[model samples]
Target chain A: MALKFKTPMLDELEKGPWPSFVTDVKRMAARKPACEDWLGLMEMSYEHKEGHWKHGGIVGVFGYGGGVIGRYCDRPDLFPNVAHFHTMRVNQPASKFYNTDVLRKLCDMWDRRGSGLTNMHGSTGDIILLGTTTDQLEPVFYELTHDFGMDLGGSGSNLRTPEGCVGMARCEWSCIDTQALIYDLTMEYQDALHRPMFPYKFKFKASGCACDCVAAIARADCSIIGTWRDNIRIDQEAVRAYANGELVPQAGAHGSEKYKLDIKAEVVDLCPTRCMEWDGKNLKIWDEDCTRCMHCIRVMPRALRPGLDTGATILVGAKAPILEGAQLSSVVIPFMKMEPPYEEFKGFVEKMWDLWMEEGKNRERLGELIQRMGLREFLKACELTPDPRMVNTPRFNPYIFYDPAEVPGGWERDLKDFRSRHQA
Target chain B: MSEEAKARIIEWVKQQKKTKHYFNDLCKAVPEIKMMQAKKIINELVNEGRLKYWSSGSTTMYMLPGQDDVAKEEKGMN
Candidate 1:
């Protein structure tokens, strides 16, 4: 326990400006002897310029295909304590809210059963409990489910944990209750979350508005963002106040003094759709032209509000760079009312899942599949109507190919007939 | 109904013999049952020790308990 091995290179990591994982491991090492050996193993890995850990064998709760990540130390002879290190992904609550008492109990349980290391939230929004043994996985899972009333998040080729922004809880601009929608979907798809049921990992993320604090549009396979159908509500008095510099712009989101609030220069000109115009006395917004990018509303929160007709915009096929390059979600269902039970939304998701499972190749992400099969095919398979909002622009270069069924006559007769007319 | 689905799923895998089946493949085994229902039956089979999960780091597949090479190699560890 008392500095089991020298870690000069690892010690150098603790001297940097940013907080280091080495320091975190050392802190955990104080309470758990296994963590000390983990540090030794890591230091050896750093010295050798290669990792010493390997993932293999069956290590998970009974009946679940995911949640526990199996890991083994390649050089187990030297670092026996960390011989069978594994990771467990605990499903986080919607928007990651927790009372101090619950957090303390979780920490206590983790300390007793594993190396007390955690990623507050992993990329998929699960509370990743790092470094535990295979033998402890079942007991830890039992304690987690029975005592804490918590379940493990998804991993492997399954539906990963769904994430949402803090909507209706604190933000006024939120068009939908992101937290509630996320909770509903999570409960409804618990099987897909725990079991490997997809060709590859599928992610669902909800943002309260187009501000997209959770980055759902860039990351999730299915992105749900709040939107409005009607015109932006304008408060004339509040607009005048902001124009006179009596009130701060962006509700002081940006430092007030650094950038002067010019209603004409900053707010009106910065509008993406160029729908707003401001004279010295009054501001007029061409609502018909507004794209609802949320910029004008953000800059003048007190002056403008989202419309009464609020709903969510659902997009499909977004992912980080993998087999295909990164893609922002394309508008699938431009707008849909997101409410409790979420029957329609859940059905839509299942329909997409059915198509992906049946047609998608192994290790192919949804976005990649969409690219391969084409968006027209995806829509046809899902029985979705084509919407104008689904595309940024129509195809410019017109080298269009027609299907045999679409042409005047079938392709079978066309080739022979064309040859008869043109040549022998 | 679940029993029938479970039997069909197991029979399909057993017929394949050495083939590691994806979750969709098991769902395909029982065409009469819904995908979610098939998923439930498969999980039940695993819990009842009739089947087991196999993984290739990123991808997860199912097979009969003794049919997995990785599990067989690390038999002593398990």
Candidate 2:
């Protein structure tokens, strides 16, 4: 494609080994004037060693307080075409499965009213339509909602879009319906998603199993990872097949290994709890010792299956660094039935939101809030019972702080008695 | 119920004698109302131009219309 603008700095990015966003933007620039102006601005940024963008302005469709992020080029005279290049976040469908017809219509709408550039899926699982004027915000939103039957995702101090891995839809290892779980939550929290109600942004991510293909545990405020309480179901014949090399180990996921398979060395020894043993003819599993980490099951998928009774483990308060350091979600509910409507889960979410909205400081993430007030306090606030499974390891130190109400006589008479016994 | 919640929130904000307030402050004002319910009312108020949003880039707060001077005065006094 011929260059519309001189983006020397951006051209340099196209030479990288990795796929470049600059190259992608240049492709969009051929059609979108906004994209061309954006490229110019970006090149100017790289040359001047500073960005020419300012954010935060009151711009959104009617009634919605979020989802439209207001951005403006500081040097508007230089790049008037992208002076008001706001970003709109369209809420994506569960697991981001999109048909071609709807995608083409969405593209047509963008081409008519705004920049054709898109993020496809943002970190929070929103379809981010980048670079549009303020005048097009309403029409774009109108087309998106009325024509496409899709609404905007969240922004600011709102409940961000809930996302999940492709659950029972595609994968065999899916223990719970992650797609259903996320969709139900998204529908139920429509008001929260559109309104800036929380002290800060909250995210929900669901993974079908503990493999955590969605990286839910590391990023979500609410991490729902599937699990089971019963034993790993085993097929001796399939096990024998895998042992004899009739079946590939890990279903050939490792890809083109030169060495032959050794069931004992690869599967049995690698089991975190040492629950599995292979004596060449038979395989023995001590189910109680298994942690349901999905290692052995993943290794020998044809042989081992998740237990009949399957659910999800709920963890809370994970976030990337801001006030405090980055945190992975900790187990709050070890396991819960993740059926439709999910009343129990919704109640839990409401309780957490209520406490956070009332007590959390502005810009404080849920994890940072949990850290600010001790985990014990958070548990008590949410009415969650203290469980041993919640912690990776119990507190090593014995410096537990007990409330005065928890003691028999309180801490009143002890002070007077101590003064009388010792020198005042 | 939303009307009542909105009235209570507005009264609470007036009582505070401040221009800007957190969404938490509104939630605190109407403790009986659920967070989602309060959010609906607040959103309605903002949309109707009775209330406005004040942003500090990192945080978003609610304020009464034309209350910039009032907030500045309050900050000065504090």
Candidate 3:
């Protein structure tokens, strides 16, 4: 078939650079000459007085496959097999295990029912299936839910998929098991994920510790971070060995230097419980006052370490309103036990969702609603006590009392100085 | 000049004299006319001493060569 190139509408870049759908379509044309017909349709759509794709058409893959978005071609006769589809992104298990048979089944189903073009993951964090008709949507959804034992994530203003970092199973940094937490939260909040009730979208993320591999601080409304209530366990002999190069540092030279110093000063001076003391030759930790900040453990991996006690710190209101761009989630429930079938964690999530949905205005995210109504009121509504650890002191606290006479000259001079200093 | 070119110039002159329109606005008004074609017609009118034009950024607006008096009269009426 002759190459039929379609001219796209030249508009502002909606998203950042990283080759878009247009670029992908062009690449397809280069490989398969028959794909040119699809490109031609795209170009002609731009030329039309109205829009390109006709609204209200059924296009998707199989009976039950989400994580993929599908758009139908208005003129299917002109370009056969030109159907739109996107992928879904499920949070990968900490062990990174995927049943090969299950994956093969999904791929085979896609090939049989829809387009062979499969994206490993979709933007919204789901395994994406591309291209299907309207009739296929219900059946595919059912098959995915019933047969595949999978569920759809984030359709409207609802709880999105819960993501987590690889926890104690694989990573050494992990203080708690994040994988179990993510799975438990998802299973418990299955109803919340499927049903839409909120004024805006909600997201959840769990990290093993403050290392924050999942980027939970920026993305999730409710962030569960692992931590310990105990102190650091220090061994003076190991520290001396590390300092003398007898033991190489896990994090390298900087870590070795840090370990040497902890042995010399912080372990002796800053240790609140006198857990660490130098007995002329070696250092010793009392073990009782070793609050696991991971500072000592991170510095001297071989010499010092964390205790067995592990729990999670919950944070709330970590998203921005749609109108005002992005915001960080704040620490709300400072510490909570994260066991299997996490009832306490689940209760907290439900309370927060209820408060946000009931009080939040249209387009207002959880963080924004809290900002407008004040955290005190929000906590009161949720029936949650004020946890000092959860309170985030605003970076720009505009609560200073302005004494008009304090300035050297006057307020005008201060204003002028401020303006001049900030003038670009 | 050909009669067709003269007629085109006259039409452009009428459009320019009507206040508040730029080259791009003219192109939009006549969807069939390309931007370059509109600019050319505008330039031809100015060359023939039928219209005058001024620019603000990329937006070039036109007016009948000696319409200041007409503008003043309209301002007075308002």
**Best of the two (2, 3) by TM-score:** 2
Which portions of model 1 miss their true places by more than 4 Å? A394-424, B1-21, B24-41, B66-78
Ranking by TM-score: 1, 2, 3
Pick out the ten consecutive residues of candidate 1 chain A with the lowest summed lDDT: A393-402
On TM-score, the leading prediction is 1
Cα lDDT of model 1 by residue, A1-424, tens digit: 4689999999999996999998889988887888899989989999999999877556788878888887778887899888778889999999998898878888888899998888898988899998888778999999989999899998888888899998889889999999999998899888888778788889999998999989999999999999988889999988888877777788887777434468878888888778988887778989887778899889889889998899899999898787889998988898899888888888889889988987788778899999999988898787887766787653444344456775687666577878988986
Consecutive 10-residue window with the lowest summed lDDT within model 3 chain A: A56-65
Residue A142 deviation, candidate 1, in Å?
A: 1.8
> What digit string (tens of lDDT, one per residue) describes model 3 on residues A134-212?
4555665666668777665553345667778778777776767887777777777665554334555677888887767
Q: RMSD in angstroms, all models?
A: 3.7, 5.3, 19.3
TM-score of each: 0.89, 0.87, 0.60
What do the candidate models score in CA lDDT, each in turn? Answer: 0.85, 0.84, 0.57
lDDT of 2 by residue, A1-424 (tens): 6765688778888895999999888888887778888998998889899989877656677777678887777887788788778889899999998899999999889889988888888888889998888779999988998999999988877788899999989988898999899889999988878878888888999999999988999999999999998888989998888877787788778984434458899889998779888999789999977778998888889899999899999999999888889999999998899998899988998888888877788789989989989888888888998776776754454345666776798785477788888996
For every candidate, give the share of true A-B contacts it also has.
0.39, 0.35, 0.00
Off-target runs (Cα >4 Å) in candidate 3 are A1-80, A83-96, A122-124, A246-300, A391-424, B1-78
